[model samples]
Target: MIRRKVVLHFPREKVDKPIVSKLVRDYNLDFNILKASITPKEEGLLVMEITGEDEDYRRGVDYLEACGVEVQPLSQDVARNDERCTHCGACLAVCPTRALYLDGESMEVVFDREECVACELCVKVCPPRAMEIKY
Candidate 1:
């Protein structure tokens, strides 16, 4: 299966649709919603991980675009600058996936990129501004 992280932008008119559910029922794809902001009559943002056969994934993405939901890679949202990081471990407390952790021996913060789901929690909490979200 191919796995991809993506951000979906829903226009006001499409905000109430069961778009993600359709990906599962119609396209036979699996999805995990990492973050979401969906308010009635307003634009919505959904961060999700989509998994399926390569062809199915492509078709599902096409379907979303057809429905007027803008799709972008999740990597575009969050990043950590190691050069600016002091390894103070402030991000560790808020990382839901344990992507940010403190090394017991070294007493320094470590970032595991693969474990990050791009939730933007670290970006908001980082005092040194090492964690940044490109939006």
Candidate 2:
């Protein structure tokens, strides 16, 4: 079964708890709250993972959109220039998804794109601007 996932960024005040609850009650979907370091005080973001038919994914997306939540497709682009990386592991420390790792033996940067949420934390934290996120 294919699982479709969406990440939504919303202002804490705008998140319709009732709507979200309704969706969970109506459809068997998984919802995760991601705390944002930048906006620590507010309800940062919502990561919704739904596994079902393609139509169900579409409906979920549409429903979330109708509820005024801005939905975006998650991408994986944590470390772009691994070759040029100085193995500082600076990006690894700030990676939101733990996508960047430093090999203990070589100290080389290892990027797991699948685990990347494309939050751009690594890009912002890297001093050399080694991590570039396209989206």
Candidate 3:
């Protein structure tokens, strides 16, 4: 099966509501909540990992965009950054996908692109701006 990381930026309230539920139920896609940064009963962004057939993936994207959610395909290059990296673990905390982790012994940041949803939260959290989306 083809897997795609779809990032949805919307008000926090919109998540776990009818809109998200419909997408999950209708598409029959596997999804995982990666990040939630909104206040209680307020707006926030949600990062989700989606996996399904190509057709279903496209349709899912279309459906989400129609609902006014900013959606995009997760880029692998963005998930793995070799340069401008300090491995400070700042990105680790913000990563909703838990794709980035620091080696406790080495004190280095490790990246698993497969687990990344490309929410760009890592890019936003990196102090040195080391993380980048290749495409």
Candidate 4:
């Protein structure tokens, strides 16, 4: 089995298409939508985690590309600067993925980079301005 988080950019013309559903019906892939902003005649953005067999994952992604969906990894290159981090645990409160948490021994916040899905909730709530998004 394979699990991948990706952001899908659907063109304005494709916004109303049943593209994502094809992943489930045709590729036997399961998905969890983290966020979505879709409008007819306007661009659509969908962030979702896809889970399926390895071969199915590849085929599904290929299908999306063939359908004119711009597929990209979920991460937005978010970085945390320890020097500027106050570790007040503000970020821990808003992180939905358990990406930020307080260490039991040291009381400092620990960041699990692999677990982060670039939700940007931590960045918005950080007080010391520690979290950064690198384009």
Name the candidate that leads on lDDT: 4
User: What are the C-alpha RMSDs, in order, of all predicted structures?
Assistant: 2.5, 4.6, 5.7, 1.7
Q: Ranking by TM-score, best first?
A: 4, 1, 2, 3
TM-scores for all predictions = 0.78, 0.62, 0.54, 0.87
Q: Distance from true position, residue 33, model 3, in Å?
A: 1.0
Clashes of each: 0, 0, 4, 0
Model 1 Cα displacement at 4 (Å)? 1.2
Instruction: Please provide, for model 1 over 48-132, each residue's C-alpha lDDT reduced to its tens digit, 9 standing for 90 to 100.
Output: 9899999999999999999999999886656789899999888988999898888999998988877789778888799989998
The all-Cα superposition gives candidate 4 an RMSD in Å to the true structure of 1.7
**Cα lDDT of model 4 by residue, 1-135, tens digit:** 998889999999888788999999999999989889987668999999999999999999999999999999886767999899988999988999898999999999999987787878878789889999976
Top TM-score prediction, candidate number: 4
Write the number of the candidate with greater lDDT, choosing between 3 and 4: 4
Q: Which is superior by TM-score, 1 or 3?
A: 1
User: What 10-residue stretch in candidate 4 is worst by lDDT?
Assistant: 114-123
**What lDDT does the true structure give each of the candidates?**
0.89, 0.66, 0.73, 0.90
The C-alpha stretches of model 4 lying farther than 4 A from their native spots are: none
Q: What lDDT does model 1 reach?
A: 0.89
Give the Cα error of residue 126 in candidate 4, in Å.
Answer: 1.2
Model 3: pairs clashing at backbone N, Cα or C within 3 Å: 11-44, 12-43, 12-44, 34-96
* Candidate 2 local lDDT, 1-135, one digit each (tens): 446456777667664355666555665555554433226466547665556556656777788788777877665444488666777888766776677887888878888876666677777677877778674
